[model samples]
Target: MRPQAAGDLVHLSAPASASLRTRPGLVVHRRRNLSMAPPHVVVRRGLTVTRLEQALVDSWPTLPPAERRAPVIRAVNDWLTTSERLAVALESAPKLVDRGALRTLVARLADGCRSPLEIWGHEHVFTGPGMPAFRRQVPMRLGLRTIYLDMFAERERVNIELDGSTTHGDPRQREIDLRRDALLATIGILVVRFAHRRLVHEIDAVRRETLAILATRRPGVIA
Candidate 1:
């Protein structure tokens, strides 16, 4: 059993049996099939435990709504698991609580959204009518250095970067971003950035601005 952030509760899964007993600080989950295939279960410190993807899906419902997405997102970002594997684990848990939300999140991750801010932008601002289908996490080579774009519109040669809250206050990060943008600009890719605050609070405005920017980038459109 994995150590939780809080509480002494230990969750264990076993094949369905009438002899199972529940006690304080112990949670037993009886399943028709308790045995997991190879690679899905690992022997850790002499105890068998579900892999990261399976454990995430199985424990999704137990976490608070706000806290649930972080672990899954972090796991994916850290290369511990992929969105594809998570989707497979999710399929095994049809009755899981808030399953639809998890599915949506996985879909966004599969689309190359690496952060919560980008996910929010995808769902709220960067989509819908007149918005081009943006390719995300696009790689571009600038000599020896290669950089990945957050969102790229191929036809317009535009890149929209979603800046997090901490980015604005960090001078070093801002300098890095500026230099990166300059490099991208040399290749004719226009970089447009929106901060976390504006993206969340000014949804309609950001969408309008993005559309207008894309329009200006078109072949015959006037700025």
Candidate 2:
């Protein structure tokens, strides 16, 4: 299904005791125990709806593999749900399809990887031997603004930004990034950015360059 288009199909969960029949556009899911725990189900406009995390987990397997991650990621990024809560919800679903992959994504989210690009960098480019345990989504308060660094090597005071494809060729965004970098530099932090293409296609080179940069920033090292 296309991401922007809402499908007509609706999934309804009912207790095993309920005799609900699926219609043309409806799917009925029968569960032995429909948890009525507080916050699990709430009355909204006179209709009961499952909580965001439960709903996401329940509907995960039904979605095409490629389409599952974005919704969960967006929900986490928007503050609608958290990776911890999602992990708890996932624990109850031992039979979930692609459970391992979903669990891995949630773990990455808990590590403060916000976007797909950041997650990609975490898996392929920014991690492994010789890499410092860089902090992800680190917050730096500068005057009135709180800027979040994508990946930060604390000792080196270096921030790595994984720029997504959407930012490519966008002059306005580039200027804003430059200004932010300058602002960071004022506080003695160096900002390094890698575009989406290089992070994905030139994995080895990116890793090497990141290590080299960190090496130069080490306390006793000279560039």
Candidate 3:
């Protein structure tokens, strides 16, 4: 996770500390020394800013339209506006890169989402395995109330859960999950269980197993 950095941090020169003080909702980050240029721009905890951020600013004035629009070039410009003194700092820094070629390549690895395939809530439902479909966290019934599921897939009423190591360790969690599954079963709703590692590492195998179960429930769907 990105550490809470002051939204308004300025670059500090070498041998100085980076700090932030939050006021209201905005953060004011600055270095101990005012005149010295920062050794480099850093974000989060001990993570240095990428060469791309530096390169873009250093050459922002001379950047051609095509070069400036490049992925790393663009990312650098975005960072400059948010980070103070970074644009000037970049101007004085050494050339971290010659061209933003790799950045462009990585940018192309987008989800390329089309109609009916985009996620409604990325915080909950996520993309996985070839980034094909949304991994819906199936809601489960526990006793008289409803509970949020860690991972879920639903077919009619059957909800499948992928339990991880963390889940089995908590006694209270285990009991709750067990009760939910049992309740689902009592209501004629199936709950197929799989290990989280299996779903992530051996996704195709898991898909095959899931499809097989679905095939059994509705035989003609596959044929």
Candidate 4:
């Protein structure tokens, strides 16, 4: 329900209740049978709503392409839902129109690619100098808090962090990033951060620097 765009009209599953007298802002979708899967539908505080996974798949066909990418990535990355769960939900959806696009998205999600920026970086910056395979959204536990790296090379302990000014340029976020970098350094993981502009304008340089760093690091040094 949260994924649905803001609207004056409310969309209710038809099976939940019979349609009321003609109303301007209320619309019922007659296609869904919520009774078939009890777990998919929830009744709380007298409101019937579908699970996030179900809602995502059911709403996939209705969304425009760019709008589709963010929600799926956000659900998996920020919400901590597994890509496999999303994939399974997608598989069960009979009316999915963008099957090819969704399959590619699911595969990238499973590989821990969280955003369009990260995906673009993977294709451009990381692929050219590929000695060690980099893992996306690598998790690291630092004391009580857990931090995720944008890209990580397990054998060489090389971590590449992509920073967008809007996301990481704030003072608070910069401080947090510094602390995380310090923690990563303490564990002998080499950290390289590239600004969004660097990746956009200086990709060739970024690729060369990345390959050089990997070349210097000893093989088989586990993080």
Q: In candidate 3, which residue pairs get closer than 3 Å at backbone N, Cα or C atoms, i.e. clash?
A: 12-38, 13-37, 13-38
| TM-scores of the models, in the order given | 0.90, 0.95, 0.38, 0.79
lDDT of 1 by residue, 31-77 (tens): 66666556657887988888889889988888879888888888898
Candidate 2 least-lDDT 10 residues: 1-10
Task: Give lDDT for model 2.
Answer: 0.88
Tens digit of per-residue lDDT, candidate 4, span 1-223: 2345576456555554555443677665654555735776777687777767766776666677768777777888676467888888787675678877887888878877888778778767787436567888777898898888889988878899999858787999999888889999999998899998899899888888888788778665342
Write out the backbone clash pairs for model 1. Answer: none
Candidate 2 off by > 4 Å: 1-7
Q: Write the per-residue lDDT of candidate 2 for residues 1-223, one digit (tens) a residue.
A: 1254566588998778888999998999887678655556877698887778988888888888988889999999889899999999999899988899999999999999998888898888877898999999888999999989999999999999999989755999999999999999999899999988899999999999999999999898877
Q: Predict model 3's lDDT versus the native.
A: 0.44
Task: Sort the predicted structures by TM-score, highest score first.
Answer: 2, 1, 4, 3
lDDT of 3 by residue, 1-76 (tens): 1123455333322323545554565434343333332444445466554233443444443444544444332343
Clashes of each: 0, 0, 3, 0
Candidate 3: stretches off by over 4 Å: 1-135, 138-143, 150-154, 219-223
